[model samples]
Target: MEMQPATDSRLELWHELMQFYIREAWLLDERRFREWLDLFTDDVFYFMPRRLNIHRSEPERELSPVGDLAIFEDDKTYLTMRVERLETGMAWGEDPPSRTRHLVGNLVAEPQPGGEVKAKTAFILYRSHHETEENVFAGYRDDVLRPTAGEWKIARRTIVLDSNVILAKNLSVFF
Candidate 1:
């Protein structure tokens, strides 16, 4: 049994996507919300479905489906509004502005039709707030990246968090 090496195109695509994720993470960690928003397309769909404890016999019932009860299901417009709210000085939960570190790894990308790439990566998002508050979230992101003006923009992102219940007081920080 032999394993074949990846083609040049595939390798290049991987490198490009990896760099994209790195820069996105950097932007988020720096709390550069507006800059981070630029990485997403105008019609981007950002979603995180809700999860529940289910019986072993009903595996598919563990996670809620899209358009159902979701932890987050923000379109680009909603995302922009959220960013705007954060930019203002009145967002209560983010008054102090939490420090965050977003780590993305284990990228797996496949080319889609019409110059798009569907990629998935495992991520760990750590957030620390004033004195005693801290939160850590681990998840996998299924993203559809579209090529736009010589760069890649996230057209869709579906975050599947590992935890069924959120322990954090507030989910103000972006994932």
Candidate 2:
């Protein structure tokens, strides 16, 4: 079916959602992991499954299945642990700290039932550390956002990275 133009209210909601995502990116880029974690609901599920470089005919094997290994499959508690680990100054992987820039764009949001909004956004994350380490991760995210206390919170998020093989030594940076 052909897509119809957004209504005025829809446009306004879209703009607000886009701004929310931009704010999220800023928080991560600023290394404010606690603040960024606050954006998610207590029951949030953040997942990033590994992709398979398979032929188009093997549709069932494209993304890692439910029981397969994923780069990130964290609940709120696990996410908190990650943030805490980074704060201890003992995470050797982040000893030098990675400077990152998160570029978020091409957002499309639609209201879902039960007072939630499902939004998809494209992102390009650039991370540089040490003297010459640099890695670029490009992907789009599917997020389910719920409003609580007049603010939006991520109830679920699935990050679909484009590449099959990640070159980064460790995914220490939050996307």
What does the lDDT read for residue 69 in candidate 1? 79
Task: Show pairs that collide, candidate 1.
Answer: none
**Per-residue lDDT of 36-129 in model 1, one digit per residue for the tens?**
9999999999999987888999989888998687999998999999999987889978888898999999998988888898999999999999
Candidate 2 global CA lDDT score? 0.91
Off by over 4 Å in 1: 1-5
Tens-digit lDDT track of model 2 for 1-175 = 1234889988899899989999999999999999999999999999998899999999888889657898899999999999999889999898778999999998888787898998999999999999998999999998999999999999999998998878778889887
- Candidate 1, TM-score vs. the true structure? 0.94
Model 2 / residue 42 / CA error / Å: 0.6
Against the true structure, what is each candidate's TM-score?
A: 0.94, 0.95
| CA lDDT, candidate 1, residue 126 | 92
